[model samples]
Target: MTTHPAETVHDALREEPCEDAWWMPGPDGFAACALSSSARTVAEARRFTRATLEGWRLCSSVAEDAALVVSELVSNALRYGAGGGGKEPAAVCPAWLALTRQDGTVLCAVSDAGTTAPVVKVPDHLAESGRGLHIVDQLSDAWGWTPPDRSGKTVWATVSSVRV
Candidate 1:
């Protein structure tokens, strides 16, 4: 998902998605799935991400990075998204994870039924949490969220690597 010089990351994030067909592994190069606010969601997403990247023969290092991004994105979706009220989400909150590769870049995007904008936090050294976005920012070529539409929002990150 190379961006033009004049177009910003936000612009890319806002691009219209074919909601029904986005996950199809057709000519556009993608894999996607539905997610819930379950505690196991992050782990499941990680495994899915790794398998998809491996199937596509992405560089191992890049696959690792993309997996991390997937972890953080899904973790955030489970923890704070879908109006979790700052605690474990008790109700089913729908979410989705999509991976796409083109040229040398692999893009990871997760959509959740939450409207909050993500923030990179300055966690205390001994803190047990709150570093998700920081890790995503460090690993990704670029990262940001799409403005929430009627349903919710999508947060995306990109990592570029050579094909294996």
Candidate 2:
């Protein structure tokens, strides 16, 4: 279920973990879910994202970009997020993925238990590393990360949902 922005302002002030329904409406024009920490999670997230976008009637417009965004975000979370602890570098950390619509804008957010903000680095054209956020910046209308609270931070991007 969705609440008007003004009506939810007070609730928004209280720091809360990113729940499946965060900033979304009920049964229409919104969806969210948690992603398990696993190497395969990125691929699974991409598939889930495409299906969800299709169910929301947005696949024809933003499915490709959304899939790429989901993949990169989840991969980053698993690679550098808290669960790895810089020891078990291959471990995947629990993360959350959410989608919401507001005034013709579709927001895609990935939450992980990492306090570090994502960095956008300029990668050499031939380089294979450090280009995820750059790709996100190129594809989404806008992108940024929320400061971590008790649960962690959420990196989000917004894309226009209006099909041209």
Best by the TM-score measure: 1
lDDT of 2 by residue, 28-140 (tens): 76666556664556766676667666666664558778888878888887666646334342233367778776655678888877767887777878987789988888778
List clashing residue pairs in candidate 1. none
Worst 10 residues of 2 by lDDT: 17-26
Clashes of 2: 1
- Residue 129, candidate 1: C-alpha displacement in angstroms: 0.5
- Tens-digit lDDT string for candidate 1 (1-164): 22234543223332442222112332357887666555656766786677778778878898899999999998887666656343343244367788989966899998777767787888777999988899998899999999875567889999988433
**Cα RMSD (Å) per model?**
11.1, 9.7
lDDT values of the candidates?
0.72, 0.67
**Please, what is the TM-score per model?**
0.75, 0.72
TM-score of 2: 0.72
What's the C-alpha lDDT at position 22 in model 2? 24
Q: Which residue pairs of candidate 2 clash?
A: 1-26
